[model samples]
Target: MEEESQIVFILFAGAFLAALMATFVVAMVILHRQRQVQNKQKMEQLQLEHERTLLNIENEIQQETMSHIGRELHDNIGQLLSLSKLYLGSSKPEKQAEGRELITKVISEVRGLSKTLNLDWVESISIREFAKQQLDRIQATGFCQTELDQEGDPWELEKNQKLVFIRVIQECLNNAIKHASPNHVSIQIIKNESGRKIIIKDDGKGFDTTIPSKGSGMTNLKKRMETIGGEFLIHSSLGNGTEIKLLLPN
Candidate 1:
């Protein structure tokens, strides 16, 4: 009976160990599942934040465009209309040629604005084509000469990614106009299996990279690229020029 009791104790110990091991495995599985759900939630949250940033940037660009339109109206088109009216009302016989010239100029300005300056609609276009149009607008100012080139197979990006790209390029163009005062701006898009790279170069009065500007928008530019899973790089000197590079992941 003592021997039988010893065998029973051994069996009990083995069963207890098996039960403990099973409990440990079940706990580990539950922990792993919880961690996976938490990770997925965090990823979703990050994507939402990035999307918000891109939308904000796009809104800012649209607002800036409206401001440009306002300036053109107040300074150029408005003034031209006023001058045309004054010329038309003149009773002096010698002012016929001048009046005709002013009227012609007014017609030309209206046609250009109606046919060309429309920049609001961008539903079906690719970002590359959109970028080309923006650079063309910059060049149309006559103060800047711009060139755009594309290489390799074009790729499509997510909507948020496209918006971020458009806004970033818009910002770069504005900065080159305002700060660098570049005479010639060159944009190139290079694509590969890995990803796409956009290079925007300007032959302008470049600034010293080491010196900090009070309110330069470089911070926003960097943040914009980071939100889109890309990279932004700038190279410039006091006299040489400025070159901006953006890289998108594969």
Candidate 2:
């Protein structure tokens, strides 16, 4: 009887152990599935944020282009039209010829401006070319001297990525001009097997690095770079100059 009792107890213990083991396995599977769902959600959220950021950038670019067009129409085209009207009013053929020439120039400028009305320019222009154009515009301002240096062949970046870089670089230059009152601004592009680096340096009244920024510009820029698997680094100090480095992987 005791032997039978002992056998029955052993069987019950074994059954309980088996049940525990089964429960553990099921729990582990459920936990793994839960984690997978959480991870997937996180990834989808990141992707959505990235898309929104890109869209915002494109919109900002469009707005800037429109502002530029408005300025051109007011400052340049308006002046040219007024001058042409004056010349065309003249009785002399020479004045009329000059007026016609000015009209032709106005037409060409309009066509060029029309081309930039769309966002296609974002895809059409290379990073190097865009940088050069920005620098040229700055130099035209006569507020600061500008230079661009390329060490190696330009790397072909995705249109979206290139657009981000352009916006960021433009922002940096703008900040230097608007806030730093930089005397000289320089942009250097270096590409190699490892990666690409764009360094923007300015001789300006730099701010202290330890001081917190008054705006969200720096944070936004850092997030923008992180979204694209790149980095934005800034260095500055009072009485010294400012430098921004944009690093991108191959």
Candidate 3:
């Protein structure tokens, strides 16, 4: 009878151990699946955030372009049209010829401006070309001198990445124009085996970096750079100039 009892006890113990092992395996599988789901959710969240940022950038660019177009229509195209009208009204052949020439020039300018109306141009334009365009605008302002220095070949970036880069550059230039009171602004783009770098510097009244900013512009710029897996850095001092550096990994 005792031997039978001992056998029964052993059987019970074995069953318990087996059940425990099974439970452990099940638990591990559940935990692994939960982790996978969490990782997937995280990835989706990041992707959504990236898309949102891109949309915001597109909207901002569109608004800026529209404002620019308004200025051109009022200040430039309007003047040309008025002049063309006066010339065309003249009885003299020379005046009429001048008016026709002006009209041709106006047509070309309108065509060029119309191209920027589509956001698709943003994706098609190269970063260097965009930089040159921005500098040209600044030079047109007559408030600041601009220069672009490049070394090595430019990197072929994804469309989204290009947009972020262009916006960041725009912000830097805008800041210089708005607050920095810089007489001269310069940009340097370098790409090689080490990495890619863009430096925007201005001879403006620099502020103390240690102090906090009242505006979100700087924070926004940093976030934009982070979205692209790039880095944004600023260097400045009082009475000195300010310099912004953007770095990208290979």
Pairs clashing within candidate 3? none
lDDT of 3 by residue, 1-250 (tens): 9999999999999999999999999999999999999999999999999899999998898898999899998999999999999999999999999999999999998998899896889878888999999999899879889999999997799888888998899899998999889889999999999788999999999999999999999999999999999999999999899999999888
Candidate 2 lDDT, 1-250, residue by residue in tens:
9999999999999999999999999999999999999999999999999999999988888999999999999999999999999999999999999999999999999999999999888888888899999999999979889999999896788987987898899789888988898889999999998899999999899999899988999899889888899999999999788999999988
Q: Write the per-residue lDDT of candidate 1 for residues 1-250, one digit (tens) a residue.
A: 9999999999999999999999999999999999999999999999888778866876776776677667777989898778777777889755666778877887887665554344444445687798888888887778788898999987687767777788888888878888887779989998988889999999889988888878848877888899978999999998888999999979
Ranking by TM-score, best first? 2, 3, 1
Every candidate's CA RMSD: 4.4, 0.9, 1.5
TM-score of each: 0.72, 0.97, 0.94
Query: Which pairs in model 1 have colliding backbones?
Result: none
Best by TM-score: 2
Candidate 2 local Cα displacement, residue 236, angstroms: 0.7
Q: Model 3, residue 160: what's the lDDT?
A: 85
Global lDDT for candidate 1? 0.82
Error of 2 at 56 (Å): 0.9
- For model 1 the TM-score comes to 0.72
Model 3 residue 174 CA deviation (Å) reads: 0.4
Mark the 10 consecutive residues where model 3 has the least summed lDDT: 118-127
**Rank order (by lDDT, best first):** 3, 2, 1
Where does model 3 exceed 4 Å of error?
A: 1-5
